[model samples]
Target: MTNSISLLAEEQVPESYGWLAGGIGAVIVIALLVFWVASLISIIRSGYSVGVKILLAMAAFAYPFLGPLIWFLFARHKEHKTRMDR
Candidate 1:
């Protein structure tokens, strides 16, 4: 009986920890995806290369906030100068 109780307790601890970790990881992945999509939309609105947009979107997955800033400063600025895209 004592062994069974201890085993149950041990199982519960790992399961709880697993749930917490999974929740946090899921949140991070979702945030990454949302930021990536937002970057894609911004690039699309400004009329950049489709391939370049895809690459820029992928970057948000790693550095969620930085991707758009870089795109705005570099890609969007150049797109304007080209003026053919917009």
Candidate 2:
């Protein structure tokens, strides 16, 4: 009985930490929003053609997190490479 009671107490989260989790979640969400907006801006300002811009914007809007990440990791680098080749 004592062991069970101890386990239950350990499983219960302290109220003090509840707000910490929420704050961390909010920060993560805000950061993602900022990243998504920046990616969209980059796409619009890029030298890519209108069709490419539209496609990239659509991808960013569609996938939210993954799209922007992929754009930064792959498309952005590809654009830079092409520009350097010119």
Candidate 3:
């Protein structure tokens, strides 16, 4: 009986950790979604042409992590250039 109880207790340990991991994953996904929306808004306000804005927004929306990378690499540089010009 004691052996059976010990086995049951060991099984519960992993299950608790599984729940913790799942909760952390949920938080990460929500945070990424919020960041994506903010990036999209910044793209809109970057003063690019309508066509360029649409392209960057679509790219960022389609790929959450990669989208921001592309925006920072290309679109954001353009924004900085425009600011310097002014």
Candidate 4:
């Protein structure tokens, strides 16, 4: 009887986690889709330069981790005065 009770307890724990994970996954996917659409629309309206447009579009709709990388690397203006220029 004790073994059966432990098994039931273990099963309930995983079922709860499964629901939580599924909810989080759904939210991420929805946000990604919404951002992707908004980015495309803004890109079209502004008619930004190809490079800038690409960067903005990518930043607007990417995995949460990707936006910062794009911002630091390509989205911001590059420093024209390099050490070699000095």
User: lDDT for model 2, on a 0 to 1 scale?
Assistant: 0.87
lDDT of 4 by residue, 1-86 (tens): 99999798777769759778779989998986665565466454553457766666666656444664444455343423321332
| Segments of candidate 3 deviating more than 4 angstroms | 1-13, 83-86
Q: Give stretches of model 1 more than 4 Å off.
A: 1-14, 47-69, 72-86
Better of 2 and 3 by TM-score: 2
| Per-prediction backbone clash count | 0, 0, 0, 0
What is the alpha-carbon lDDT for the whole of candidate 3? Answer: 0.81
Q: Any residue pairs clashing in model 4, and if so which?
A: none
Worst lDDT 10-window in candidate 2 = 77-86
Residue 8 in candidate 3 has what lDDT?
85
Error of 3 at 62 (Å): 2.4
Q: What is the lDDT of residue 6 in candidate 1?
A: 75
Q: lDDT of each model, Cα atoms only?
A: 0.72, 0.87, 0.81, 0.60
What is the Cα-based lDDT of residue 84 in candidate 4?
Answer: 31
The candidate with the higher TM-score, 1 or 3, is 3
TM-score versus the correct structure, for each prediction: 0.47, 0.77, 0.69, 0.44
Worst 10 residues of 1 by lDDT: 77-86
Ranking by TM-score: 2, 3, 1, 4
Candidate 3 least-lDDT 10 residues: 77-86
Distance from true location, Cα of 19 in model 4, Å? 1.1
Q: lDDT per residue, candidate 3, 1-86, as tens digits?
A: 99999798678769659778778989999998888888888898887778878988888878988898777776687776565344
- Could you tell me the C-alpha RMSD of candidate 4 in Å? 9.5
Rank ordering of all candidates by lDDT, starting from the highest: 2, 3, 1, 4
List runs of model 4 lying over 4 Å from the truth: 1-13, 49-86
